[model samples]
Target: MSHTSTMISEDIEAYLKEHEQKDLLRFITCGSVDDGKSTLIGRLLHDSKMIYEDQLAAITQASKTSGTTGDAVDLALLVDGLQSEREQGITIDVAYRFFSTDKRKFIIADTPGHEQYTRNMATGASTASLAVLLIDARYGVQTQTRRHSFIADLLGIQHLVVAINKMDLVDYSQERYDEIVAEYQVIADKLGARDIRFVPLSALKGDNVVNRSEAMDWYEGPAMLELLETVEITHDQNRRDLRLPVQYVNRPNLDFRGYCGTLAAGVMSPGQRVRALPSGKVSTVARLVTWDGDLEVAYPGQAITVTLEDEIDISRGDWLVAEDDEVPLANGFEADIVWMHETALEPDKLYDLKLATRDVAGKVKAIDYQVDVNTLEQRHADHLDLNAIARCQLELTAPVPVDDYRTSPGTGSFIIIDRLTNITVGAGMIHRPLDSELPYEFREHDSKANVVWNRASVTQAMREHLKGHSGKCVWFTGLSGSGKSSLANALEVELNRRGYHTMLLDGDNIRHGLCKDLGMGEADRAENIRRVGEVARLFAEAGIIVITAFISPFRADRDAARELFNDGDFIEVHVDTPLDICEQRDPKGLYHKAREGKIRDFTGINSPYEVPKAAEVTVNTEFMNQQEVINLLLKAL
Candidate 1:
């Protein structure tokens, strides 16, 4: 038997004997282009006797055709399989390889080393438990080295191994390796890469990779292979909050219904009380099932279908989480994205933000900052190009529950898909959810596909032109009995008499039908205004002047409604009336009930009213009568 084959046989035999005790370790190798990343992985596979006989022969033959190292068998050919990759002698895609040792099994992601392929590297690092960052011994610590380390730190990979490669070019000198390690330590510390280990080895000669080489007798640390076989990774996942994003609903026939998804974190049992989000329905798990059998308990990374005790509604993209989880409900966020597309990201252009299994309307609200690749400092940028890393404020038209990536990775990482071409344009990690008083618009887009996104035919301008007047929404805001609904009704009657199309959306009339399901709370009030704004926009689109008379007390909520319309289309008319006059003229007796403590969240009573500071039209109801106010509004419109 060949010497390499003998070693393979021994390792396989040992692994078989200790298979029950072994654990899997996932790691990625990354650094600057031409820094021997692929070669080092190939050398590790070769020296550890992991490759098959025919595979070794194919690489040996491929070396003769186009190899970086002359005469000797090119090991990099084993991992760099693409035509463009082998032609340029660089890795353009993430190549994953599986191999085993007696102590542990490993999944190694051979990521791209070029600066332009930073997105490709991020894809590999997203799930890595450890990062084997390579640095060229000849060049010392370079830009790519710092970038990989920074990204690894950003992705929350705690364990880092800095492999200073090509030591043979520098005569395997301990001093040169130490110099590079010292330089890297400064940057790693700045980036908060705490658990770091450094090693020096020559990949071409297969020294200090699998076997401890006598050439580096000055080095007494473990070999790279030994470190992989022993590093613990059982506790890498967040195990506190049990998260299972419903991926599929497994239903076979009339008798069966199950909610199926992979357990993203924590353990699951048959009787645990789980709450499904976006709906917030609570239920108990009836059965913890799998294809093999019914499991008594399931851990993270296990795929299982859970049957709820109650017939609660659960669907795809709904999160079945622990009832007491600290996950934040987010409609907008400011995240760091690695722009992967070639075209520069345009400002305010809508993209589909796909998180886990859900896709929502998203756009780059603002470019907060970008990283200077060399200086490692945050710099202001307006747009991002290919492989550009920047922190952008992502504005979503809808909200979802989020856990910070540092705490829970499965719920925090996402990608932006181009709505036109359906291509993945960027990858992002949510740093925190935006907590402004008014959140982003979470509405879905209604554009048809296969061309530039437009509403197709019957444009808003055409509708307005046919009506002989510009369609608009005159939104009246004030406390109850403050002449808001009366003014809106009179305005609607006046517009109708003047041969203009009009519709009146009164607060009580809307709550009876369109908003029948909503309750009287702060969130419900915001949603009420949002729905009213949507209806007003649709009415105006049909060439009708919409008059919404809701006591939208919060200025923030009113501002969010304004964003739903074109400029000048939303005319905020504040019906200025004092609290005492509003109390004296209680039309619905709501003020009397509020004063008697029978009503909760009644505007101008328990719920505070934030009067408009810069409303377009201000009508002092204390002085101006109904006729004067109607005439004033007609002239303004």
Candidate 2:
């Protein structure tokens, strides 16, 4: 190592202490085929004096027979250790190397530059904070180069170093270098990386690899090693939200019990209250135990066992977070999936999903779209093949705490394993959770029944054009007596007076006819809304404005209803009348009967009413009259 000093021979403990204090950086090298990824890494190690003489001698001997370079010792042989890799002269797997300078320690992931091994590249980029994208000076840019760059950005690599290698072949032409930089700048702009630096270097000739190049006088930027040594990476960790996914429960004896995990993000200390996910159990940290000793404070990436003041139920696959943090409990989410298996992804087939330390069974419910990496276009795809990338909706068997990948990657990324084969088939980064879990009846049945959606020749657009207006679903939801029915009635009448077609589906009227068999239980209410939503969808398809008024108590049912319509077609109106006012204005005398213990599961009395979190329009009947609510609804429409 370049940091080797006389203290190593005189005082070993002092040397070890000094070496442990240096900052560590993890980075990856990726690009198109034969782009000098391995050569650049070997050159860095060779020039930095980090290689041993015996290993160097072995490579020198091997270079005479297997080296790509003629006569000269091939530096790329350092990382290409596999027999297949040496014989083929191409990287087939991820190669790792370690080196250090005076300022910082570094670990380099030398990734393959082939389209077939895109999954290997993704594996390397997942843990990398920076990417060294090598573009051959002669080729400007290539398809694999764009693909690797997109994957690097997608994996949340904040810093990018665009290494324009083999400048010697291009005669160190500043014009050629500038052109490649310009082309890559467009990609960097699309990535929106926090930091991007470009350097023109010849990895074989050692030009600008460790020292300034006399051949490329026009390029005045720092050399590749200097940039690596000085680049800022301390801000990359997510320190605002504490996350510790329990990997193991240490119970060696009856007197000791600790939760073992590497702190994924944020800070933790003794006495800090922690909440266990999926159980909502809270406890305070009593100790941060490690093999050496106890730590006063625990930072991200530290491996330690945490003992709690209160013994609550905690096991593997549960997350311990700060009590006040708001990580979402998700049973369904949308993610960008990189499929790596030969068998095409079966949307209905279940797979083992491992996120952090949590493992659960899940399945892909839908494939929203697949990406064309070269042009970055989204195309509709029904199934994903090997090395395919797509955005998919996944349904989990149980809820788990999750964060967006941009927020905390440790808890936001996951892998899909084949249940029978026990092989990893896919990787995913969560974009966001779905609004709520679909009711069991709303999900696809597992009976293997033959079903298909039939298409019609008469399109909705044709019907809408004939009516001179677009169809819409104006859904009104609130407590029973909160004027949802009255407002829905007024809006339909006004729309009809203006010569627009309208249909009103009132709750009482529907129960008397369409939902007469259903009761007021939770399951029956959800089914009732599901039936109404389908009928309203049919009316809207006929070019008639559909209006609905119901005390849709569950947010999940409301969200499911909204999913049936296209964007901007479903407008949710929340009636924000107070409970006191609703009880006083109870038109059906249901609130009075509920207070006298005569009614069961009456909303706003015995049953809970979940307020909408992001309703489109909100009206308060206590403050606003029916006409005002109707006018607002019309304006929104």
Candidate with maximal lDDT: 2
Candidate 1 matches the true fold with a TM-score of 0.66
Report the C-alpha displacement of residue 613, candidate 2, in angstroms: 43
Writing each residue's lDDT as its tens digit, candidate 2 over 308-402 gives 98879999999899999988888888899998888999897999999999999999988777888777787767689987899898989998887
Worst 10-residue lDDT window, candidate 1: 449-458
Q: Candidate 1 on 252-292: residue-level lDDT in tens?
A: 99778898888888888988998988888899988988888
* Ten contiguous residues with the weakest lDDT in model 2: 437-446
What is the lDDT of every predicted structure here?
A: 0.86, 0.91
TM-score of each: 0.66, 0.70
Off by over 4 Å in 1: 1-22, 436-637
Each prediction's total of clashing residue pairs, residues at least 3 apart in sequence or on different chains, is: 4, 0
- Highest TM-score among the candidates is held by which one? 2
